[model samples]
Target chain A: GPKVLQIPSHQIIDMGQMVTLNCDPVSNHLYFYWYKQILGQQMEFLVNFYNGKVMEKSKLFKDQFSVERPDGSYFTLKIQPTALEDSAVYFCASTGGSSYEQYFGPGTRLTVL
Target chain B: QQQVRQSPQSLTVWEGETAILNCSYEDSTFDYFPWYHQFPGESPALLIAIRPVSNKKEDGRFTIFFNKREKKFSLHIADSQPGDSATYFCAARTEGADRLTFGKGTQLIIQP
Candidate 1:
């Protein structure tokens, strides 16, 4: 089975600080996605990336959020001026263009204090 | 409004029993339905999925029965075991869309 890896499984940050969550998607996969899941709540889609650019985003994707793959490297999500509501598990997913299945990482638990 | 809805926030089942999880959606355009299972401290993985073109899909003990007209679907786990205890999330995606709209999730506990 293929696996997607996330760096710093857990992160604790002070409010108003900048945090970058890194995801190493499956090597051969092209589509990348980011989702936010608050405790006891449904997982919400934030954004999806392809061809080195954002293809779609949800209302949950605030102006403070941005994503980039940077020359086929780790797909990164950067959030600035982190708010308390940003505290949640951030999951990264990837898919091969042809399949309906998307592989998800273990997720980075971001705690904004 | 929630686009995807799942019933029974939590469920408990005895070993060897059948566990039924229900899901419904508000979007008629949503044609792809996927069920994902997540264990504590892990990311969700796809358990099974179905398209509108098919009314049912089966994989081992896991089965999906979809009703496009009713805009509902369900996952039936036969011969449920302790290992089947986990949170199940039903999600729907529009055709050719890369994102999934997930239900609130249902936690299943299998008693021995």
Candidate 2:
């Protein structure tokens, strides 16, 4: 049972502010992903990163959003000048080579006011 | 557009009853289907998964029935218990795809 850890279980920030969500993916996992879930809605894929580069991104990944692992450290998702609609629980997931299973973190609940 | 869809937004099943959750996808190229269940305060954990190469996958009381021709699949929980109450999400991804398309999840309630 691999575990992914996310910092800041909950965050409340004013609109137009910048927020960074940190995720410590499973130790050996190489692929990282970020997903956004509005309350009672489906989880939407925002982006996926591998080898320090973005592999794919969805429309939901706005221009204000960015992601970086920073020299094999914690994978971080940053949103600058956040909008009210950006308020949602963000889950980080990771998996190793050739494995179809992606283990998800506890999720960081970002609330924009 | 939703690539993955699950039926019955909410369901309540009595103990010992079988609960069936349906899911379908719009993409025919999707080769992997996985079901994840989340408890009240926990992250979604992989419950069971299946590939198009098989029509059925069984793991203890949980089973996945896949229909590649119809682009549909379903999860069956037999002899349900109260602990089985959780939100179940059906997801799909194509081969070599890194992102997963998830359904709007089915909230399952096991009535004792």
Candidate 3:
């Protein structure tokens, strides 16, 4: 079965610090996505990446957020100067193609104090 | 706009009973509907999916009933077991769309 792997299952950071979340998608997948879910809220799309470029992004994806798939290795999301409101569960997903289903990772829980 | 909505925030049923989860969507362009199940501390897994062109799709005890005209769909779990307890999310996506819109979610508990 195809699986997506996320590093640092849980992270706690102080306000104004930087944090980077990493994801290793299925080897054959071509599309990668990031979603965020606040406690008791619906999951919201953050951004999508394909072919080393950002395909689409939602308003929730702020200027402090950046994603990269450098060297075909880890796909990472970095946030600079994290805010308290940034606390949530971040999920990474990948799909083989447009029509294929997206496979999700266990998620990284970020708690900002 | 909330593209997708699900009813019954939570449900509890006996192991041998049938659990019906309801979902509705507002986007007419949504062509793909999928149900995802997630256990505590785990990522969501794809349980079943259906296309708008089909009225129903079944795989084992999991079934998806879609209504293209009404923009509604539901997931039916037959012969439910304790292992089936989890939070289920209804999601909608369209062709060429890079992201999926998910409903709030429904927590189902199957008691043995």
Candidate 4:
């Protein structure tokens, strides 16, 4: 079975601070995605990355948000000048190709005060 | 547009009973549907899935019934157990796409 790993299971940060969420996707996966889920809400797609470039991004992905897969290492999502509304569970998912099945990581719970 | 919608925000059933979770989608282009289950403090895992071309797909106690014309689908859990208590999400993706649009979710409780 394939697995995706996310670091810093839970994080707490003050408003206006910077936070970086890390994800280690499945070894052979070619596509990476980021999703956000608020309390008692649906999981929303934030962005998808492939071949070192962003393929698509939702409107919720703001200017403060950025993603990168530097040197074929961990895929990172950085949010600078975080706002209170940024508090939520950020999930990382990966798939071998463009398919319906996407393996998800445990998720990084971010709390902004 | 909200692509996927699920009914009955929550459900409670006795062990060994059958639990049915309903889902509907508005995107006609959606050809793939998957149901994901999530326990508290854990990420969602795929339970079962079906393609629009098929009317039903079953794997053990989990079953997915898809109606292509109506754009509706449902998940049926047979012989439910307390361990099956969790949140289930209905997701859809169009062909040749990797992004999945998920429904709000249904919290199912299988009481012992």
The interface RMSD for candidate 3 is 0.8
What is the CAPRI rating of model 2's predicted complex? Answer: high
Higher-lDDT candidate among 2 and 4?
Answer: 2
Candidate 1: clashing pairs of residues: none
Q: A83, model 2: CA deviation in Å?
A: 0.6
Instruction: Candidate 3: list runs displaced more than 4 Å.
Output: none
DockQ score of each predicted structure, in the order shown: 0.86, 0.86, 0.86, 0.78
lDDT of each: 0.95, 0.95, 0.93, 0.93
Candidate no. 2 TM-score: 0.98
RMSD of 4: 1.2
Error of 3 at B101 (Å): 0.5
Which candidate, 3 or 4, would have the higher DockQ against the true structure?
3
Cα error, candidate 4, residue A104 (Å): 0.4
Kindly report which residue pairs in candidate 3 clash with one another. none
How does residue B8 of candidate 1 score in lDDT?
A: 85
What is the per-residue lDDT of model 2 for residues B58-83, given as tens digits with 9 covering 90 to 100?
99999999998898999999999999
Native-contact recovery for every candidate? 0.83, 0.80, 0.83, 0.69
Model 4's DockQ score: 0.78
Write down the RMSD of all candidates, one decimal each.
0.8, 0.8, 1.0, 1.2
Off by over 4 Å in 2: none
Q: Give lDDT tens digits, candidate 3, residues B70-99.
A: 889999999999999999999998666768
Residue pairs with clashing backbones, model 4: none
